[model samples]
Target chain A: MTDTLIVPTFDEPATEAAGRKLVIICSKGNLDMAYPGLILGAAALGEGIETHLFFTFWGLDMITTSRMENLKFTMLGNTAMHLTQAPKMPIPALMGSIPGMTGVATKMMRKQIADLEIPTVPEMLEQITQMGGHLWACRMSFDMMKLNEADLYEEVEAVISASDFMEISEGAQIIFI
Target chain B: MPTTMIAGRPIDVNDEGFLSSYDQWDEKLGAELAKLIGIDMTEAHWAPIRFLRSDYPARGETATLRRASTVGGFAIKDLFELFPGKPAKKMAYIAGLPKPKGCV
Candidate 1:
């Protein structure tokens, strides 16, 4: 039998620490809930940290321009105080016969928010992209909602699957806003 | 009450007694102070005082004038690095100065 002696290496382990990455999951449908993730992500990016905002479910409306104008901040709904007690009127669905009530509401809400010095969602998106933060739309959610790529805001980087998002999320600090 | 402004925002001197502790901040040197702080002389009159008051502990009571200029941008962190202790008092003292505002 040949005896093989195992020797341990004495050098200090040179471990490559992972770079800081933060993932923000935006799920709210209205303007008040939407700005936090965008602002924080952009600020983080400005600080030279990698940031990602993943839009899923109702949050997917954040990137879709066609649906963007229809985001409702209803008094009947549970939304931020700034948007509370606003109109929640329903629109008729007669094959485009009636103008979208939500769109009208969004415009009113946008005006109110602007008057209060709150930035709009599109403005937030512009800031986020300018600061090099990434925006990902959930592929399944987009398909389920029957949304087309043309309907989305210009800054959406990709339509990613949940698994792909998870792969990126594994080592990141994930926050659902 | 010690007070100054940066970027149009008002800042109170941190230590409660410091504003009256020192004589009125010289308004003639305000332009020079603004230049040192790297902010416009007009905009530096309010917020810098409030910010320095709120973040005074990061600056010691007697920080070198060179370190005072960094308070405008990296406001809190730079002050802490320069003063290490009693940053609030130091920042208040600097904010009270008739010297040029930012980095020379």
Candidate 2:
């Protein structure tokens, strides 16, 4: 009988104790809404953690340069005001169309971040990517929107599916914003 | 009572009822601040406070409102911002915190 020592092999060892995987899901076009996830993900990256931002649905719109530069505060389509009082309510599309509503919401959001000293979405993304955070664009959503690769920011890591996002999200702090 | 400025606005340290100065934050002051924001300075919350204190301005100087707001904003926003696909909610309460007695 041959006696041999058997050692289990794990593809990704847990050798790095301090590193963490954080995935932020951005589904809004508002700069205010976009900033927090980008900034936090960047901060996590700065701390040596592995960070990923999965842009899906409306969020895919924000990551694309074609729309980001012209991003609108679409009060005409906001569903949150009429939605149930659940914390994660959507902005009412009808209300979003109301005159001045979009501007009001936009200004309010900007002011709040100003008061809190949080960076804007463009600024946050610029810093986050420069700092090494992995950014993924949802392929299905991107396709649904008909956005081409050229429409996206230069730093986009890849256009992947939800399953890929789920696989990346495992073991990481998942933030849906 | 030491008088200081945060973001060019004067804040009285005495009215805050603690000996914390611009340089170092007193542990007791941190506890009071945590309470004012309705946060329990427990294992989960203490580290952030410690991190904030580390950014406290040195004596005879003040931290930018932009910088200090990060700490205050995170505290308020964490409790408030909760929209789907939205950033943390902004808090008006942070701006409403009582100013030092006799100093607006």
Candidate 3:
């Protein structure tokens, strides 16, 4: 008896369409944590996927009108920052705790992202929204921070509850950043 | 190399059922495509599809969901409701355009 080999082609239209929904949850507020959500969201939108970003907890600061442009990067407790920025001669961890070091690090990092032509957090938020990605602020965070809708950037579609987000994110590939 | 008959006309489509040529697209063809996907064409569905068809010829790219929502005057949620999951791909496919670049 001859054995007939049957190979199945896995690249099907249904599978391709099924993987198209992406929901990104941004739970961290710092400069380092912020970019992954925005960058991935932007990339997803560029690829014609239905993308939504849900900002909660500290991440809520990213969509606020005042805080969006002024996100900070603290070197203290961030060993990765010290290693990457000054690889040959790493700064002492104690120096990172010095006052004004965070401000300096934030400035330098901002310059690096700018020099690389990467959009700032504010610009990335704008571009993502303009390109058809949805930006939603968490209502719990908004209320906890005593921030009104007016406090968020106009690009934010709504200040939504977890239930609302769940409704929209149903059947989506959820990513937490 | 596959062909689907729409409104008594033969239209070429790819193996996965996307139209092979944008030239063969018409309102009737779009409606037929929507039907194949189990969607009945409504004004809401037509809005983005029409926008994509016209917008693509000028821009040479697929409109992002946000662009479609803004330019087509529909809310982003409305788009999700209209196209369900994978609205961007569904809209591009029904619009008789190539699978939008960057789309997985």
Candidate 4:
């Protein structure tokens, strides 16, 4: 059926109280970039908003079964990471390039998130899905990666074309991360 | 902590008029609620309502519209037509559950 059939057009007060819709695009796969989309999606879901997360390009990895649980943070070429970790003192790029620096940073960041009681990526994604948020994978990226649906988390509702996403996301507030 | 008398029985509800206790829900109460919300309980309506009633206690969460449509075996448009304006909220109420968390 057409979307118009489901879109509420009633004048009742209850109709006016309907929740808003949010569409988030996760284009980055880095551990740091992944949180924004997941966090915002969770927050939106918590607020009664219908939330959709579209993962594309590198972001597709964030939803992949193989990579999602093992996502890592890298300090190399990432000045923002140093700034966040030590606002006043910057770690030199050479230091970040050291072997195992990325692992160290990833561990530290994971610990911080845990200590803060923030849900880890898997937890966040699962909660979002449980709360009824929609997760979509980009069709183009899925093909480019030679990935199949089984490669991604079961929470992903579908692998959709951008045009289809646009159609589904009509009137939604879109955010790109 | 608000209560409303429906069909001569006093029932507790939240601020949004959802039944405070799942145990208090029955087909009679559901029909009463549907009437109060200007809906006529149909087979279509009962599908989601029954699904929610069973799923909530098992899963401890309300199903989203998509889930209801997909797993509950109803079209999204059918749900909208059944409840008219707010299918999710209406389904929860009719099912005698609290307003599904995260629903506006």
Top candidate on DockQ is 4
lDDT score of residue B70 within candidate 2? 49
Best by TM-score: 3
Question: Each prediction's Cα lDDT score?
Answer: 0.56, 0.53, 0.77, 0.76
Q: Which digits, one per residue and each the tens of the lDDT, describe model 2 over residues B18-98?
A: 333443444554454444444445553444344344544332222222233344453322321221111110111122221
- For every model in order, the TM-score on chain A comes to 0.69, 0.69, 0.86, 0.86
Question: What TM-score against the true fold does each predicted structure earn?
Answer: 0.49, 0.50, 0.59, 0.58
lDDT of 1 by residue, A45-164 (tens): 533456889998889998899766556654334342232454464433432233564565557777877775445677667656754568899988889999888888988988899999
Worst 10 residues of 3 chain A by lDDT: A1-10
Candidate 3, which segments miss by more than 4 Å at Cα?
A1-19, A83-86, B1-104
CA error at residue A101 for candidate 3, angstroms: 0.1
Rank by DockQ, highest first. 4, 3, 1, 2
Give the TM-score of chain B in candidate 4: 0.89
Candidates, ranked, lDDT? 3, 4, 1, 2
Error of 3 at B86 (Å): 13
In model 3, residue pairs whose N, Cα or C atoms come closer than 3 Å (at least 3 residues apart or on different chains), thus clashing, are: A47-B102, A132-B66
Per-residue CA lDDT of model 4 for B39-78, tens digit only, reads 8888877878999888888877777554575567776556
lDDT of 2: 0.53
Identify the runs in model 4 with alpha carbons over 4 angstroms from their true place: A1-19, A83-87, B1-104
Residue A14 of model 2: what lDDT? Answer: 24
TM-score of chain B of 3: 0.84
